[model samples]
Target: MRLSSLLFCLCVASFPVMAAGQGLQRSGPMRFLYDMGVSDTDTSDPTMRQQLLQLREAGINVLSLDGWDAAAFQKLLPTLKADPLFSRFKYVLKIHPHVSSNWAANPTQVCSDAANGVLPADTAQLLDGVAAFGKQNADYVVGYYTFDEPSNKGVNNGTTICWQYQQLVYQRLRSGDPDSTDRPVITANTLYPVAPEDIKNSVSPNAQDIVFVDQYSTDPAVQATEYKDWGNMLKKVVPVFPAFSNNITTCQDPMLRTQFRPAVQSGLNTAYGANQPAVAGIAYFAFYPGRTYAYDAQNCAPIFNSVVDDLQHDPIPVMTKIEPSLNLILSCPASSSTAPASSSTSSEPCQ
Candidate 1:
């Protein structure tokens, strides 16, 4: 076996096993998902498998793909299933109607169906096709992400519509396949200010299995608050996965690679790893090198290693010690469930 693979196995075997009351348990339980765009049909990319191997070694158990469709997943599954190491890692397939349309189609912009108040005609068809795909690949498939950030404008508009739409798709998948590995519905909402309760309740634990909150802010203070608040809210309802970003709008932003970058990563590992019973794990934003950002996988090596180190060394005690100060500096008034939805809008995806 490769040195990286051997080390990764050793690190995973060393993780502190927890009891039932500590957190919700699931198959192949892992806390970090590296969210990026990867195709199953890249026959020419010889280095693709190596990059994925390195990622798994660095403690990322989930591969959350952004621009992947049902057809791409269908083509890719066999490749992953054939490899023992790759097959061990989980997958989050982003579903859309057409492969080309998914390149820019934001889940928030999906219009609601007039009759049933759910996704529009095109999106509904997309969900059905995606669910059928999930049924065909139940063992290795983890979940499906239909929407990016519904709390923002262009999606649910702070209303419960997005959650309702999630239910429509989630229920269909579950009812379609009653097997244990068939439950897979995932959504990642922006955790700026706070995630609205209306949207949160729309897909309760009974409706959806996992929820992710993104923290793209450069300010560590904001990152801490987002993690704590959103983590607490979604703890019991579903396993919370905090999302991180390697590069903002510009990949060369000095702040991103310098002060702000370390702070953001540290804050994520600390707040999410704090003895919180709800936080299942954390996920990073776009890992696509030339596609999503100029930053390559090498740029993320330190961050990935740090995450593995934190998990291996045991961050609970350290996080517990720093919790009080973080709460003090980042504290805010209780979020009002009735607060007005922000007018800020974005037609683009939240990657």
Candidate 2:
């Protein structure tokens, strides 16, 4: 379980073609976030280790614990800290809001009234908890994200206030933690059939700091364009890490069930989408079957494997190389060109 025994396997054979001299640099490789929220498997189980190893082999670097509460996260920290495979991975810790307030769903809507205080009691408590958790386990914790798809409705109390809340929460989370002050606070955004400009403007500036817009489309051309537009707009201000689906997308075909499952279609879309050149990296969503809470890896393997394969073979145009002296592994991707050499893909494990 020691870090020295770790190895990162890349399946480059599955890729279409590699441009000469274009290699996925050890420090600049795409970072994937894998959701283990609704998954039936738990990190405490024996099978969890194997799962983590396979994900690593497939090029996934971050494991997201979305559904786990703060107490549960604290309990699992030691196990994640000790494991070698985990040592190779970063984590997105999802901390729930304090009691009497459903901030995860809509902090802006719930705390709109003045009596709720300028920042609200639950919001401050949430920040305190996150700061403490982050300070205690700063090594493995890369960033924190709790809200899911907050921009569903146009900018309203639900959406606009959420940004304000995010500003406060992010400020509080990084208050005393000087090391992780620049860490990303990511949230999922809505992607309807409306004009792309509308969707772009709807996203909050705070939310755009670590952009992750999810779009599940049947057409790769459309998906590619969407990725490009979104990437162009968001990349200027923040790093863009979009989510790719594993579900099928042929909505008009006859015998829909008889056709490829959603996951199969998603896998195809992923294959086409990854080659778009605009895509920086992707976070794989295992929840298929109409977004039902389930992690059917058997159904999702095709897309997951395809995206991982693409990342391994295709080296993205390096945005900024890692500078080793900063000692800021979690925040390196968003950091400037002065980053130190990366330890995740390099021989040294990220400290």
Candidate 3:
């Protein structure tokens, strides 16, 4: 093994063994990006394997299976679990029932269906699949990504059903796993601004256990303020995971791209310094190449290569530097039905 790879393994070995359903309880902070963009077709590809190894060495400990449903994950997990390189990182699996659909194509229709309880059976089956998968692969799994940007303007339009949908998913997941101790439900909100009440209403103890807030702006000030604002706003309601923008579409300028590191650093500083709610971890908006918004459906080889290059140069070093100071504050205990008491302290460098 390479020196860095050896070091990473040794470091991972030193951390306490993670118990099922406690969420990611690493010694250092959980550092991950949005999606690996892996599909069933390329699960056995040699080049894709190498790229995953490179990402692990690049300081990302968490791997997100962004768009994969339960069946897709079931088929792919055995192959991934057997691979030494792929098995090294923890995963956040996507379990949303309508993951393959385009929410923007017809928000009203989608929202109406979700509101009217059109997919309860589908949702229950998906949750059961995930719960079974988690029991079988407890070590590799961390949480479930139940929805993405549910209240975005052009997406769910902050509909009451959209918010209720989150509650339904959360309730079902917990009903099966009892407190989601084995695997908590996670959701990501849009980067676009929303009202504070709407944001609060969208999240509840009965809904997502953890919430990822995405804000992409080239300016460090904008990144810092918005991320801190969102963190402060939702920290008490749910554990917050602040996502940084590595997506090139928004960060077109090369110099501005370099500013991402400080932007994330400053955001963490302000959020923790102000004594915000429990910040579970940090995440990048994505690792996929090309524009994330465009949903580029290209070959996996070139896309994986581009992602490897981007990681080797930019976000990896930022994560390497920032990760050390981020200590996991496990003082905030997990609750079965209610939100955990806010136990985050400003004394710790990062939480």
Q: Estimate each model's TM-score.
A: 0.56, 0.58, 0.60
Q: Return the lDDT, model 2, position 90.
A: 55
lDDT of 3 by residue, 1-351 (tens): 000001111112122222222222221244444444344225555544444444444444666553345677777767666765555555667655353143334546655665675544555677777766765665666667676666554555445235655676676666666635335567666544666666665544456766665555545566556655465335311222222224434422223224444464455455455444454444544332343321122222333333333333432111222222123221222222211112111222112
Taking the tens digit of each residue's C-alpha lDDT, what string does model 2 give over 43-144? Answer: 555344554444454355566544244566777766655655555555666543232134545544644632243566656666677656766765556566
Cα lDDT tens digits, model 1, 1-351, are 000000111112112323323432221233444433445235235344454444443344555443344666777777766655455555666652242143135544542442265545565556566677766765555566555554554444334344555556566556555542334455555545444564464434443555555556666677667656655445322222222234533223232234544555456556666454333344433432243221133454344333334333222211111123111211112222211111122211111
Residue pairs with clashing backbones, model 3: 21-181, 21-182
Error of 1 at 57 (Å): 2.7
Model 2 spans > 4 angstroms off: 1-30, 38-40, 44-48, 66-71, 96-101, 104-117, 154-161, 178-182, 193-202, 218-280, 288-301, 315-351
Q: Which candidate ranks first by TM-score, i.e. highest?
A: 3
Candidate 1 TM-score to native: 0.56
lDDT-based ranking: 3, 1, 2
Better candidate number, 2 or 3, judged by lDDT: 3
Query: How much lDDT does candidate 1 score?
Result: 0.42
Supply the TM-score for candidate 2: 0.58
- In angstroms, the error of model 2 at 276 is 13
Q: Model-by-model lDDT, in order?
A: 0.42, 0.41, 0.45
Top lDDT model: 3
